[model samples]
Target: MLALLPLVILAATPIVLLLTISTERRHALTAGLALTGLVGALLALPTAAAQAPRDVTVLLRVDASGLAYAALAIVAAACLVVIGYRYVGAREANPEEYYVLLLIATAGIVAMAFSTHFVSFYLGLEILSVSLYGLMAYFRRDRWGTEAGMKYLVLASASAAFLLFGMALIYAELGTMTFAGLVAASPEQMSNAVVLLGLAMLCASIGFKLSIVPFHYWTPDIYDGAPASVVAFASTAGKLGVFAVIVRYFLLPVGAVTSGLTTYLVVTAVASMLVGNLLALLQTNLKRLLAYSSIAHMGYIAVAFLAHGPVAAETVTFYVLGYTLASIAVFGVIAVLSTEPGRTSDLDHIADYKGLLRTRPVLGAVLIAGLLSFAGIPLTAGFLGKVYVVLAGAQDGHWFVLLALALSSVAGAWYYLRVVVAVCSTPDGESALERPSVPAAPTAVLAVLAVAVLILGTYPAPVLAVIESLHR
Candidate 1:
C-alpha cells in the first residue's frame, strides 16, 4: 500500500488543486501547491523503495530502478514548477491551468516510470503527451507557442499511432502485453516477422520522443518556440520518463534475442550522434542549438543503453541523472535571463550573450558549467557521463559506436566553446551587456543544479551505489 502512495499523491494533487484553489490564489499560491505535491511525492520514494521489487498491480511495479527514475522525474518537475512561478506570473496567461497541466503531466511521468505492462505504458505516454500540448502552448497569444504546440500534437499523435499498431502486432503474435510475458515468449517467437516488425514500430515512437535521427524533425522547432520553462521540463523530465520505459523494455530477455531490433538501434544511435552534432554547428539560435545538442546527448545515452553488460544499467542511470542536472541548470539560466514574459526569448541569439560574464557573473559561471558538461569537459558531470557510456560501449565491444561518440565529442566542443567565448568577450554594443532582472526562485534553482553537477561529477560513488542497488 505504501508503495503506491507516491502515485496516489501525484494523481490527487492536480485534482485537489483544480477544485480547491480559488482564482485569488493565482500563480504564486497555485505554484506553491504544485511544488508541495511534488516534494511530497519525492519524499515518498524512500518508502516505495523499501517495498521495492514488488508488483503493485497488473500494470505497475514498485522497485528500486523505477523509483530512482521516478525520483529524477519528480525532481525535474519540482525545478520546473519553482521556475514557473516567475515565468507564468509575468505572462498574460492563466496560472491555475498551467499548474493543473504541469501536475497532470508529472503524474503521467511518474506513471511511466512505474509501469510494467503495455496497457499502463501506453496510457502513461498519452497522458504526458496530451498534458504537454497545453503546457507548450500556454502562452496562447504567441503565434510561435501555438504553432509549436500544433506541430508537436500532430507528430506526437502520429508516433503514438505507430506505437499502438506495434503493440497490436506483438499482442497478436504472443497474446500478451506484459513485459514478463513477452520475455517468456521471446525464445519461441523471436523469429516471427510480425514480432520483429512490431518491435520496429515501437522503437520508432521512442525515437521521436528522444529526438533521435530520422524521427527528430520536430525537436528544434518545438524547443525554439516553446517557453523556456516548458522546454526545461520537456527536455529533462519528459526524456526521463520515456527513457525509463526504454531501459526497462530493452533489459528484458526478449531484447537480447531480437537481432533486428539491436541492429536498428545501433544504426539510429550512430546516425543521431553524427547528424545531431553536425547540425548544431550551423545554428546561431541558442534554443535551436540546445535542441540539436539534446539529440546528440540522446545518442550518447543510447550507447550505455545498448551495451546490456553488468555495469550497463548503472552507467545509464548515472549518465541520465548527470545529464538532467546539467540541462536544468542551463535552462534555468535561460529562464532567468528571459527579459519579457510572453515574447520570444531575449537569449535567442549567440551574440545576445556577449559580455554576460562581466554583467551577470553568477549566471555566466553556471551557464559555462552547463555547456561544458554538454561538451564532456573534465571535472564536470557531462564528462563523467561520457566516460561511463564509453566504458559500457567498450565492455560490449561496440567499436563503431565508440568511434562515433569520440568524433562527435570533438565536433560538440567547437560549438560549445563558441558560446563560452561569446559569454566572456567584450560586449558588441551597450545594449548587449545590460543585465536582466534575475528572479530569486530560478537563480536559486540554478545554483542547486550547478552544485549537483559538480558533486555528481566529482564524487559519484554514492549515486552509483543507489543505482547498483536498483539494478535487477
Candidate 2:
C-alpha cells in the first residue's frame, strides 16, 4: 500500500475534484484542489521511492524509472493547471470540469508510466485518449476545434484497435501479454512472422503518440486547434508517458526484442528527424510549428535508445524533464499572449507577434530563451539533451542515424531562429502588438521553468547524480 501512494494520490485527485465540483462550481476552488492533489502526488514520490524496484502488482511496478516518469507527468499537469488558470477562468464554459478532465488524464499518464501489462497499458491509453477528445473540443463554438477533436477521436480509436489486435496476436503466439514475458522470449519465438507483424502494429500505435512520421498526421491539426494549455500537456506529458513505456519495453536490453525491430526503430527515428523538421519549416502558426518541432525532438531522444544500460535511462529521463521545462515556458508564453479573457480566438499566427520584444519585453525574452532551447543552443536545457543523445548514438556506433539527427537539428535551428528574429524585430508604427496585461499564474510558472532551464543547462551534475543514484 505504501508503494502505491503516488499512484493512489494522483488517481484520487480527479475523483475528489468531481465531488467538489458537484458542490461548488468555482474555478478557483477546482483549480486549487487540482494543484493540491498534483503537488501531493509529487511529494508522495519519495515515499514510493523508498519501495523502489518492487512489483506493486502483475500489472504495475514501482521502480526508479516509474518514479521519475511519474514526477515529470505530475509536474507537467501542475504546470498546465497554472498556465490555464486565467485562460479557463475567464471563459463562460464550465471551467471546473476542465481541471477534472486534466487530472483524469494525468492519472492515466501515471498509470501508463508504471504499467507492465498490456491490459494496464490499454486502459491508461484509453483514459488519456478519451479525456483528450473532450479537451480538444472544449470550446464548442470553434469549428476547427470540433474538427480536430473528431479527427483525434477517430484516429485514436483506430490506433487502440490496432493495439488490441497486436496484443491478441502476440499473446496467441507467446501465451503472455506482459512486457517482461515478451522481451524475455527466445530468439526463435520473437522471430516468428506473426510476432513481427504484431510488433509492427504496436510500433504504429506508439508512433501515433510520439507523433513520428506517417503516424503523425493528427498532430498539426490538434495543436492548431486545441487550447494552449491542452496542447502543452499533450505535447509534453502525454507523449512523454508513451515514450517512458517505450524506453522500458524496447530499449532495456538492445537486442532483447529483435534486430529487425531495432532496424524499424532506427528507420522511424531518422524519418521523423528529417520529415518533422522539413514540415516544421512550412508552418506559420506558432502551435503548429511546435507540433512539427516536437516530432523532431522525439526523434532526437529516440536515438538515445541506442545506448543500453543506465546510460540510456539517464539520457532519456533527463532530456524529457529538461524538454518539459522549456516546453512549459514556450507554451505558457503562448497561453499568456495569444488570448484575452473572454476572447474565443487566439493570436496564434506568426504575424501577430511582430515587435513582441519591444511590446512585451519579459514575454519576449522568455520566448527567445525557449526558442533557443529548441535550437539546442549552449547554456540552455536543450543543449544538454542534444549532446547526450549524440554521445549515446556515437557510443552505440549508430553513426548514420547520428548524421540524420545532426542534419535535422541544423534545419530545425533555422525555423526556430526565424521565430526569434521576428520577436526581436522592431515594429515601426502599426505592427506593434498591444501589450495586454498578463496574469500572475502563468507568469509564475514561466519564471520557474526559466530558472529550471538555466540550472539544468549550466549545472546539471547535481540532478544527473540524483538520477544516476536512482538507477544504481
Candidate 3:
C-alpha cells in the first residue's frame, strides 16, 4: 500500500481541489493544494522506492526507474505550476480550475510511470489528453488557443481510436496485454502479420503523442497557441509519460518484433532530426522554433534505442531530466519576458526580444543558458546528454544515427545561437528594453532551473548512479 502513495496523493489532490473549487474559488488556495500534493508525492517517492521492483496487480509496477521518471515529471509540473500561478491567475477570471486541470494531468503522468499494462497505459494517456484539451484553450479570448484546442481534440480522438484498435489486435494475437505475457510469446506469435500491423498502429499513435516526424503536424501550432505554462508541461511532461511507456513496451529481445519497427522508429528519428532542424531555421517565432527544437531533441533521445538493455532506458531518462530542466527554464523566461500585458499567450516573435540581455540580466542569462544547453554547448546539461546518447548509439554501432545527431547539433546550434546572439546584442538607437516588474516567484524558479542545468552538466554522477541502481 505504501508503494501507491505517490499516485494516491496525485489523484487525491485534484479531487480535493475540485471540491474546493465547487464551493469557493480562490487562486492561492487552489495553487497551494496542487503544490502540496506534488511535493507530498515527491516526498513519498522514497517510500515507493523502498518497495522497488514490485508489481502491483499486474497493471502497475513500482520500481526505481518508474519512481525516478515520475519524480522528473512531477518536478517539471511543479515548476510549471509555480511559474504558471501568476500567469493564469492574472489572465483568467476563474483561475482555480486551471490548477485543477493541471493536477489532474499530473495524476495521469504519474499513472503512466507506474503502468505495466496496456489498459493502464491507454487510460493514463486519455486522462492526460482530456485535461490538455481544456488547458490548451483555457484562455477564453485567445483565438489561437481555441484553434489549437480544436485541432488537438480532433487529432486526439483519432489517436485514441488507433490506440484502442492496436491494443485489441495485439491482445488478439498475443492473448495478453501485459509485458510479461508478451515476453513469453512464441516465435510464431512474434512474426504474426496481425501483430506487426498492430505494433505499427501503436507506434503511429505513440508518434503523435511524442510529436515525432510524419505525425508532428500539430506541434508548432499547439506550442504557439497554448499558454506558455501549459506548453511547458505539454512539451516536456507529456512526452516523458509517453516515452516511459515506449521504453517499457519495446524492451523486447533482439529480433523479437523484426525489422519493421526499427525501420519505422529510425526513419522518424532521422526525419525528426533533419526536418525539425531545417524547418526551425526558417521560423522567426520563438515558440515555433522551440517546437522544432523539441522534435530534434526527441530524435537524439530515440538514438538511445540502438543500445541494449538498461542502457537505453537510462539514457532516455537522463536526457528527459536534462531536457525538462532546460526547457522549463526557457519557457519560464517566455512567460515573463515575452508576454504582453493582460495576455496569457506567449507567441512573441524573435525580434521582440531584441535587447533582453542588456535589460533583464537574470532572464537574459537563463535564456542564454537554456538556448546553449539546447545547442549542446559545453558546461551545460544538454551537452552531457548528447554525449551519453552518442555513446549509446556507438555501443550498438548505430553510426548513421550518430551522424544525424552530429549534423543536427550543428544545425540546432546555428539557430539557437542566433537567438542567443539576439539576446546578447544591444538594440540600435533606442535604449535597451526596460525590465518589467515581473513576478518574483517565477523568476526565482527559473534561476534555480538555470543553476540546475549547469550543475547537472558538471556533475551527473548522482543521476547516473540512480540509473545504475535501477538496472542492478
Quote each prediction's TM-score.
0.96, 0.96, 0.96
Q: Which pairs of residues have clashing backbones in candidate 2?
A: none
Model 2 spans with C-alpha error above 4 angstroms: 250-255
| Residue 464 accuracy (lDDT) in model 2 | 92
User: Could you tell me which 10 consecutive residues in candidate 2 have the lowest summed lDDT?
Assistant: 250-259
Query: What is the overall TM-score of model 1 with all chains considered together?
Result: 0.96
lDDT of 1 at 297: 89
Q: In angstroms, how far off is 301's CA in candidate 3?
A: 1.2
lDDT of 2 by residue, 175-242 (tens): 99998889788888998999988888888888877787878888888888887878888888887678
Candidate 2 Cα lDDT to native:
0.84
> 228-330 in candidate 3: lDDT tens per residue?
8888888888777787776675554544444666677678889899999999999999999999999898888778776756788778877888899999999
lDDT (C-alpha) at residue 196 in model 2: 83
Better of 1 and 3 by lDDT: 3
- lDDT at position 233, candidate 3: 89
In model 3, which residue pairs have backbone atoms overlapping below 3 Å?
none
